[model samples]
Target: MENWEAGWDDGEVGESSFDYSNHTKSQFLDDVERRLKLFMVRCVKVCRTLPGSYDGQHFGQQLIRSSSSAAANFRAVRRGRSQKEYFAKLSVTIEELDESLFWLETLVSTDLMPEHRLADLIDEGYQLLKILSKSRKTASD
Candidate 1:
């Protein structure tokens, strides 16, 4: 049997059996979930520090929606039934990540968030964008 098949149990395989770079569904989803969680945490921290005015509330809501929706759509991708479905759902995630990066830039540029303070969150969004972009490109090819 193949090395991976050796680790299979009943029908599912355990995480310890393989490296994340193996591109197994569970590991990939787990990594993306962790990334989204970190992004959401940073967003909340910055949002809490924003001025409690109309602009803050509006932009804060947008950021929250985009970040959270990307996380949610990844869940759909995890359950995707076909290559077409996976590509479609993953595209949504990439779009949301794109929006999240835009909001991050806007927050810093508009002085709603300090660039120094928000650097990690903004950087994480950009990094995720590149990773997901590659995933989409590979899926299409």
Candidate 2:
């Protein structure tokens, strides 16, 4: 049996017993999801403050959809019934994460957003993408 199954049989299923450190996989995904939801709310607040410019409107729409989609797709992945479906949903989650990153970059680069404020969100997006990509590969295998 694998390490996880072995641990399960030994009744070592608690958080302290699970060795998530030194591994990219994390229980932190729950925290990330929570933060992402808050970040999306902030994005919506920022978007609401923008003037009626074409670029601003367009980017605001993209940012809102993509940011929310990341969380939505992740929740879907969690509910997936099979490994294949899980991987597929994770792939979608990755796409949404990427799109969200792109919108953030565009906002910063185009001077629509302050770089300092965008930095944290951008870093979080990158970290989430890395985690989700690893998850997808592992699930697919």
Q: Score candidate 1 by TM-score against the native.
A: 0.80
User: What is each predicted model's overall lDDT from 0 to 1?
Assistant: 0.71, 0.67
State residue 125's C-alpha deviation in candidate 1, in Å: 0.9
TM-score of each: 0.80, 0.75
Q: Spell out the clash pairs found in candidate 1.
A: none
Please identify model 1 stretches exceeding 4 Å from their true place: 1-25
Model 2 residue 72 CA deviation (Å) reads 0.7
- 1-96 in candidate 1: lDDT tens per residue? 222122222212222222344566565667767777778777767777788889888898898889888888877877889889988998998898
Worst 10 residues of 1 by lDDT: 2-11
Q: In model 2, how large is the Cα lDDT of residue 61? A: 93
